[model samples]
Target: MLIGDVARRSGVSTRMLRHYDALGLVRPTGRTVGGYREYSAEDVRRIFHVESLRSLGLSLKQIARALEDPAFTPSELVSDLIRWTEDRLEREQELLGRLRTVDASAPTGWQDVLRIVELLQGLASTSAARRQQAVLAQAEGVPVPAELLAGAVLSESDPNVAGALRWALARAGGDGVAALTAGLRSEELDVRRRAVGALARMPEAPGAAAALADALGDPDPTVRRHAALALGGRGVTAAVPTLVAMVVEGSHDVDAAEVLGTLSQDPDTEDRITTALADELAAPTADSATRIRLTQALVELPGTTAQEVLRRLAHDEDRAVALVASAFLGLIREQPPEDGHDERP
Candidate 1:
């Protein structure tokens, strides 16, 4: 086949074929009567081979080396192609995500588009200070979209930046909640924790509250504690058991106790709160230290039931638990009964 015939048959442009010949890659095996380049069947096959390699993301030079150099093993070249493809794919995916975030923002003009892009870039910045400033700029009336803030919140490792992201999301209102909910379902433990933490700080809208309620069942203890504490403060008695468990485990037990105390203001939940603490205290598996923390938590609960439980714990078998419970009971007794109701009603 002549160069024109080869171009027509193989879909390789004639100009590209000439470039291939000039580069000494797939030169024709013969010349026609008019001195036009003519390709033998073997040369045509080599041309197809070159195109095949190019399709696999091989540089033309790499393709020439692979075809000409007997020692040029394909293993290393293939690995390099894979790495390059992966890097390109990652860049494309990141660009697509940015575009989607911008589209979600529904920017009205180039200025709005630029502001959103800059905020998105800032949120993804290496410096925590920059990320925090991006979030705070929203407070200063920058139009950072809620979806971007939610994404930042989920991925932010720095505590301060994460807090600012959550604050910005809260102000952004319900738009961030959907992204946060998706983060809650992420298999990554840290992402789930961050999602729950952000949701916990948000206003107790039905969506956020529901997401946090689901997070109460998260496998991570940090996630569960954050969710449970937030729910408890919102008067969700479902968090009472987890809050009591927190006291037993001595993980954020003080904050857990305070939320529990706040939940106990309702007459219906006060007994349940007392019972949860009593059960943890009486559990056979609870060690001395666990029992002591549980005793301290009981002090946060009001009502005669907690007092009665504390009175029994004050003379318990463990010396440390007994001494702590006795001290707590003494303080409860010394404080006027009216003081308890004064704080509640």
Candidate 2:
């Protein structure tokens, strides 16, 4: 077969075949009557082999080594090809994601497109400062796609940057909730914590409260604690037990106690919160320190029930518990004469 016939038969262009010949990749073995290059059957087979290797992302030089070098073991070369292909695939996937984010933004013009790209790049930057700046910029009207913020907030490790990202996500509202919900289901505990944290910031977003409520049962105590605090702030009485548990565990227990106080303002839930605290106080699991924390948490409750609980605990068997409760009750007694009446009177 002549070069033209081989090219036509193999789908390799004649110009490419000539280039392959120049590169000594697949030289035709004979000459036609016109002195043009001619290909024997074996040469045609080698041409097919080169094209086959090329299809696997082999460079021309690498293909030459693969085809001609007896010392070139395919194991290492194939491994390298796999790595290269994976790298290319990862790049393509990243590009596709960026394009999707841009498309989702529905950019009005090139300026909007550029701003979104720049902000997206910043969110992915190695520097926490840059990521934080990107979030703040988006908050100030950078038109960043909400999904991009959702994705960033999940993986952000820097406390400051993650806070900024969560703030931006809250401002972005309902659009980012799906991404955050996906984060809540992540296998990594840190990721789940971050997801719940961001979702907690957007309590008013559709399903945000529900997502946090679900997170209340997360195996990670930190995740559950955050969910409980957020839910408590949102007046979800279901979080009372977890909030009381937070006070016992001393995990951001102060914040948890404050949120519990807020939840207790509702007459319906005040008894529930105080009851859970009293139960935890009486449980055998409550060590001296646990009892102390629970007693302090009671100080946050109102409507005289907490004061009555303190009066009862003030005479408890544990001296430290009695002292703490007595001290709190003392502070309550010292504040005299509200609305022209004193509790002592």
Candidate 3:
């Protein structure tokens, strides 16, 4: 079929199809005389597989390599993936811990974070070693080389960290990931997390996503959270389904739901996130705090889908859940009860 037809049938975009082609991810089986792409049924299924893995956090290059080698073993991929996964989890845990502490009525300060941010901002403007050290001391416990630290906050380019990352990418290109990816995993857990954070700036790699996926299975909850965050940065829609599933299994439901929200750009993907949230509401599996958090996320969605789902949950035996759902229905529709109106027989 043509690109539009394939997009309608497969739920993948035409632009992505071309990207897959460039990466040898999904090449058309044949070409039309007019030079348009052509695909077979098998090609469509392959696209689904590509979509699934991309969702699972594999990169295009890794996807290409995996396709070339059919005997691919998950065990070999899982090991290195786990190492970096721990790093990511530890860092997100630190940030989350601080946030939770602040969120709780605990007397605390973001003064530390603000200080760190200010110091990094100072060093990041220009390359001055003495000034960088002064800033580093003030921002103690802040990762050194504030430039890279800055980029770790995002997956995009920053003048602060670009030079070193270029050298790292070059070294990885020449010596391969064994020397770079593998060694970084051995650093202190926080440093490792920062390294995974660095993956934000670099281009996607098949293994990086896979590694992030494996990290989702880490024994620690915080590690899994960071893994989810890292996956969001590099992953495609393929990560959506898994992310939805994770929402149910997550020990930290609020965090999981928030992570899923980031992937809700596409309708199909957004539907999945909403559906998962609905499923949780319907089941009453989440605690009160979790349900509240989930409901807030539902309200934040772009449509009435979540509200509709809550109405369905009104059938539940748990009066609290049903009552909550009913209350949500009233709020979502932006109405209040009428005095003796008798709207319902």
**Could you list the CA RMSD of all candidates, in the order they appear?**
3.6, 2.7, 27.1
- Give per-residue lDDT, candidate 3, residue 70: 78
Which wins on TM-score, candidate 2 or candidate 3?
2
Weakest 10 consecutive residues of candidate 2 by summed lDDT: 137-146
Per residue, candidate 3 scores C-alpha lDDT tens digits across 1-345 of 887789999999999999888877899999999999999999999999888777746777776777678798767675766776788899898667445433432324566555544544554455455333433344223333323333333222443453444434433332222222442354355544544444433426435565556556545455555566657645455555445545555554555556566666566777877877777655645776556556656654554566566666665565666677677666656643356443321
Summarize candidate 2's per-residue lDDT along 136-221 as a digit string, tens digits.
87636655667888898889999999998877777776898888999999999889989998988888899888899999989999
Best by lDDT: 2
Sorted on lDDT, highest at the top, how do the candidates line up? Answer: 2, 1, 3
lDDT minimum window of 10 residues, candidate 1: 336-345
Q: Please write out the lDDT profile of model 1 over residues 1-345, one tens digit for every residue.
A: 888899999999999999999999989999988999999999999999999999999989999999989999999989988999999999999999999888887778998888888888787789989988877875366556788788888888999988877777887788888989999999998899899988888847549999998988888889999999889988898898899888988999999989888988876798988988888877889999898888888788777788888889878989898899888877766776664553311
The 10-residue segment of model 3 with minimum total lDDT is 171-180
Reference-based TM-score, model 2: 0.89
TM-score of each: 0.85, 0.89, 0.38
The candidate maximizing TM-score is 2
| C-alpha lDDT values of all predictions | 0.86, 0.87, 0.57
